[model samples]
Target: MGLCLLISCGESGKRTSVDPGTDTQDISSEESKPVNTPGKKTIVFFGNSLTAGMGLEPEESFPARVQEKIDSLDMDYKVVNAGISGETTAGGESRISWLMRDRVDIFVLELGANDGLRGIPLSETRENLQAIIDTVKNHYPDVKIVLAGMQIPPNMGPEYTAEFREIFPDLARANQAYLIPFLLEDVAGIPELNQADGIHPTVEGQRKVAQNVWEILKPIL
Candidate 1:
């Protein structure tokens, strides 16, 4: 697959099976609220459908898989999946404050891909992401931050696509946050890794994603 497929996959992946306008709004009001589990550290996976595991069951999502890994290690961290299908960076900026109600030990920020796909202004995307990071820092000064990098196809123009790729790392360095180079690393364009929509990852693909995340996250625990 070419770079175009990468960006195309993200665009379609964000909306999954629903209408773009209708589905990409707010994630479930219920899911937006984070519930802290007593006696456990919290890890919040915040992003769009990829984080939400759009085409799969809640347990089948990468966040859920991460939970399984933590359990095996007998770690006491709660993985909260705050992913919403079709969410954009602006949506995440607005929604993040609500999830701050509970304690968050590690925050994995995974929002920008949708904004990139929709041709949202890079400034707006960067600002929204920065705001999110700022809010997290303000709420929990000691919380660890993890930024997931995203890449889009050059359909948006080489300059735009290149800049989009730079956002995550730049934010990471600025915030001193951990960075996962690409959330969909091995799963993006592989036909078998993706679902029928050629967007969302299949079950096995999610596992690969979980591994990608785990590589960066395990040491934090």
Candidate 2:
């Protein structure tokens, strides 16, 4: 897995996926049962370091921001940050079942960047991502999914890059999931918005990231 967690603007690097079953740091909260409450719903955000708030505090993370929004709107959803630092699609595939230890009313899938960065076979990336989706559906048949699309640098090749970018929308349509095209829309590559590593979002960037997610997510909620 070529996970570019260090610098979004520099050379790409790979890393093994963190096992969600064992790695507890990325999880925002823990629940032993199949969900939170009888009336309230649960939204499990499944992604890589980007979702984990790699370079920032858990409070400054987008997931925490989402929690604040939900609180203000008086919504009844508890967001669970099931993000893992340095995770790839395949890693997500392996860890999804564990995260699903609790029910997922909404599953936000933000992955595939590492695959594109690693220049893995597009078909493999697509298949692995599909597998992750399939796993979620297998456990929670009625769970609504929000696929947060990601993009990678063009270092791989224009054709490969284009096809990779197209993967998210394709998956969304095929899976009938909500699409938030380009999760890094206005935040990627912007120096002031990123941490020193240039990959992870700073606190300000995460706030904007929260807005980006909320725009697409609120309607779904």
Candidate 3:
């Protein structure tokens, strides 16, 4: 499938696109300002199905909620959901260059859950994620990164589960990026928050997930 690019305009009237090879350094430097330009901050949400807002309307996804929040605050920021269902860390790495070509102020990196679910090797997942971080850093050293963590189901066994859970924090520290303890902190495993498939979150669940992400994100934004 062709890569998808989502762009939203904030009050500042600046338009952001998802084009790989864009000058991220310029974007990152601009984001560090005490106050954002009239409408310039562009936050990209990158991940798999979870970020894609599976089972929910596009506008109802967590990224959309974040956009709404920014709008409500009248912040000069736009939130773009770049999530793809069933995406693995490897897949994300392959697309990172192109996906981030546009000017991106902040990146919410969420991946690896599908890798764990598919029983992919942890080492491979780590390498893929690390590569993504390295590339982003090389392109935009000052860009703020928020690494979202995920936990594999207990059925994955203790050894694999523990290792998978550690990847996010480890990568965040290694990359000097911010960390969100758990992407699904209050939503995962909660029957009321999940859909019939039990894997994806329902609308209510996404709200909580958005809140979980927002908690860490607000401080940086």
The candidate scoring highest on TM-score is 1
lDDT of 2 by residue, 52-73 (tens): 7776677788988998999999
lDDT of the candidates, in the order given: 0.83, 0.77, 0.73
Give the poorly placed runs of model 2, Cα more than 4 Å off: 1-35
What is the TM-score of each predicted model, taking all chains together? 0.91, 0.86, 0.82
Q: For every candidate structure, what is the RMSD over all alpha carbons to the true structure, in angstroms?
A: 2.9, 5.1, 9.4
Worst 10 residues of 2 by lDDT: 7-16
- Candidate 3's residue-wise lDDT over 1-221, tens digit each? 11111111111111132233232323322322223344587788887667777667777788889888888887878787877555677767877876556677898899887678767899999999999888877787888999998887756688998998899999999988999998887676677777776667778988998999889998898
Point out where model 3 deviates above 4 Å: 1-38
TM-score of 1: 0.91
In TM-score terms, candidate 3 sits at 0.82
